[model samples]
Target chain A: MPHDHHDHDHLSASGHPYRKDNDGQLTYWQTMEIAIRELMVEKGELTPAQIQAQIDAMDDRSPANGAAVVARAWTDPDFKKRLLANGSDAAREMGFDIGPMHLVAVENTIDTHNLIVCTLCSCYPRNLLGLPPDWYKTREYRSRAVREPRAVLREFGVDLPANITLRVHDSTADMRYIVLPARPEGTDEMTAEQLAELVTRDSMIGTGLPKSP
Target chain B: MTLTPGSTVRIKTMSPLGHIRTPHYLRGKTGVVERVLGPFKNPEQLAYMVPAPTRTLYRVRFEMGHIWPNAEAPQDTLDAEIYEHWIDQNAP
Candidate 1:
């Protein structure tokens, strides 16, 4: 069996990961998805291999893609300008195919701080930053991120000074936003790759700052 | 009406029961157009799998104070992308 080669600690009897939703109870959405997938496969609309490949491609995307872009912007002023002007093209320049997503890069400066939230639904830059954090999809985060941004940021351990202006972006429509966090001081000697190491996923989301060197 | 960047406009307050991209909180709120994000298919029609006409979308910026009276940071701002049909050109 497939379970023979896998670690038993985290695997269920079915050899699938132990998740709350995988408790043998199929949800309505899950039922619909399975039925649709099977029908599509039977009708030759899509092959099982094609579906698996799509899933694999999505799983391959991570925050590291966004980190590399941030690092490049920090080290190269010209690239940073281009990134600020047109984020989609800048990401494409790095060889990351973001598809038809319209990306907007908002800069975080000493006097300004940017935060992103989708009040209507979970509209995220998945192509660039992978899937959004679970907290981002929560109703509380979606509601409070715009109403009381300062308090919400403080909850995430990001306390801003009164002098700094906060800008909360609500992803209501087509465009996806990424915060271009300010570079931490005293990293002048680091390479672009080394700088990417400090760029955290939360920094790009505007919830937390980049790690200090 | 074509809205230029830096033009002050108010979001139309309409609660049509359907798949709308506009959030309820932004209705009747006034803001400045920060940028014109070009034209895109109207999501209202697209959600129903029907033909949708392209509409110009704008990035509108609003001051926190204007949105909420008891705003913790009055100087802070909020930005959202609004479709052309949702925006009212006449701003008092």
Candidate 2:
């Protein structure tokens, strides 16, 4: 018989393991969330299994998905053309299942640079890149990004030359944006998979550049 | 009327009490339409869970100096998605 490794102290009276979050004091919002979730489950509107599966799906998404797209664009001209023309369709073609997010791809060129922010709220391309970094949602970043993009980019270690025009995109409504960072030079020999290793989440957000090979 | 790309338009300055997507800084500022982003349900109405009508959204590109008095770089630009109702086509 297989030995059970369950720790007695971690188990409740009902023999169920205690969730880590259950230890904290329930705030008003947490209480409300529990109430609503229970009500929905009781009313048969949703199942506990369904909710867990949904969470699992969200957890599965990460910046790696976006890195692959960026790498593909770097290597393939036709894919890059389609990606620039229609970001949502191109991502769908790659089997990303980004849902109804109207993604717009802004390219970083030799003379132009692109940055994205949501001044109204923290609207990000969560489907493609997973949850945004904590700083991206802060009031400081949201306001500074549009007002002084050059200064903001400098803080992120991306100092643009005076010749390069900085373009800051405020995702106010309907559409989401993803920056197609300029492909680093001297990467002509690298494969798409190897190139993907260099695409960081910050690079996609236009706050930083891809890692040098 | 649908706004064409490259047409100059100004965002109307108004502070109605409700959930609004138009940023306060861009109000009364003029910009050129970068592209027509098609129609979307009015977020102001959708926020209240009401029957929202569709409104055309345009990507307007504004000069940094035009939007701010002490812009770090005047030549740099800012682009934002503005709804049809917030844009005035008759701006001089």
Candidate 3:
């Protein structure tokens, strides 16, 4: 049998020394994260159980929850009123607790469209719609979304009519924001469930729109 | 200072060292108070895992042309939530 050499030194593409741990096992940041977490737990800042519970809560959410609320808002005028008035309370009414972060739902109208972004950081309505997309966290998007919103919307394949003005909401503070996209023209006859299916995550972010028909 | 909706206010030009929620571009810019989002704990201090005092936050609206004067469209608008401390009652 040919001699099998199993040991091969692996190096990170960037040639960063921090990529390797004591035994070349874990990355420096990974090791540091573990150290910090363990220290916090040891110091009684927070228990591992508390961290796990928060993770579990986050894992339980998805875009479908927000879509369901949007669909309900489309079907029921009363619910729509409530959702616009107080988003967190309205979400709770639909069996979703949006945590301590106050959520604000802004409606898209025929005259104007609304786009949401966190220029300072990726501050999003995670309780209602789960974690944000990778692009939403990028610096390119964060800066461009506020500086040139119409251009950014175009890149997302959202070509708006000149008659309609665009409104960009930079979520720089505590209140989380979600866009209530306008109901597609041909989706009037669809059931709430059917309508929910057309409500894409990007639509709620104001980067795109619901499926037409 | 509490500002009613539709009243114009200017963002202060102070960038204190440490965690800040206000964006650099919006500093010293003028905008109208879209809505008062009520009082909340100061996030600038909260970021450092320290106790924070409650401060009033307002949703300030800035016109697109005003924010980016050279932009193609003048009808557009942008909104950002700013704390009461970072705003001046008088607009420039």
Candidate 4:
């Protein structure tokens, strides 16, 4: 057997920092990210502290943010109108900064349902919904969503009536989309805060629906 | 280029050999200008980490049947954001 040369404080034999799991082995993409980050820091393009801060900032968001926007839209018709008219501004009203990208809120009506997909990439409304689920970044979801959306929805446990036309939005370029699913039938009496609890991340992505109360 | 919302437009069919935002499935597809999404720096050039001029982007809506002939519901639709440079005159 080979000698165990792993060290925690110093670089391993392969020049990579020893992680908890792998014996100094890193995936290709992970290695690339590490190399690029190190190069940027060495060139003074960005400091390691700045990169860490950016990562921390990304972690600050979650699906609950999107749920809050959805719940507010369901409770207030005026807010719903504003959200449908200008999603970025409406999100701001709820204290969510969506950055520079343009956001569009698509409403799911009795006759129509909206589904969002980034066929070319996994571009998502990260500001409101946080980072996308792992499956969202997979090639399977990207291609299947554009080709057979209903089938994909069924897998996610969202079954719609055949009469209800399904509209699929392909986010090809800069625009990011979020679906405002129709409120569940029995939620008429629920408060906005209570309704928000029923909203799931998948619902905003158009793959699921709010829990029925 | 400024596009009037609701005006019918056709996506030009051009397969450039480089990083392009327009998907192959939407090439030569006809759609209506849903809204102007404003101007932004060209991502194609940004990918190279170079300074690029801003380009207008538009949200275009297309009928499901137009994109996929065998679409289950004829009334279904699909919307996509396309750069202004990728669009041509309206289809007659």
Q: For each candidate, what TM-score against the reference?
A: 0.93, 0.92, 0.87, 0.86
Q: What interface-residue Cα RMSD does candidate 1 give after superposition?
A: 0.6
Native contact share for candidate 3:
0.82
Instruction: Write one digit per residue (lDDT tens) for candidate 2, span A42-112.
Output: 99999988988787678777888899999999999999999999999999999997878899999999999
Between candidates 2 and 4, the TM-score winner: 2
Q: Once all C-alphas are superposed, what RMSD does model 2 give against the true structure? A: 5.4
Pairs of colliding residues, candidate 4 = none
Q: Write the per-residue lDDT of candidate 3 for residues B1-92, one digit (tens) a residue.
A: 75899988999998899989999999998999999989989998899999999999999999988989886677898999999999976555
How would the candidate models be sorted by TM-score, starting from the highest? 1, 2, 3, 4
In terms of TM-score, which candidate is strongest? Answer: 1
> Which 10-residue window in model 2 chain A sums to the lowest lDDT?
A1-10
DockQ-based CAPRI category assigned to the predicted complex of candidate 4 = medium
Model 3 chain B: worst 10 consecutive residues (lDDT sum): B83-92
Error of 3 at A196 (Å): 0.5
The lDDT per prediction is 0.92, 0.90, 0.89, 0.86
> Would you list the clashing residue pairs of candidate 1?
none
RMSD to the native, candidate 4? 6.2
Worst 10 residues of 1 chain A by lDDT: A1-10
Off by over 4 Å in 2: A1-22
Q: What is the clash count of model 4?
A: 0
Native contacts retained, all candidates in order: 0.96, 0.96, 0.82, 0.76
**Model 3 ranges with Cα > 4 A deviation:** A1-25, A37-50, B49-51, B90-92
What tens digits encode model 4's per-residue C-alpha lDDT throughout A47-122? 9779777876777778888899999999999999999999999999888766775789999998989999998989
How far does residue A176 in candidate 4 sit from its true spot (Å)? Answer: 0.9
Ranking by lDDT: 1, 2, 3, 4
Model 1, runs deviating above 4 Å = A1-8, A11-29
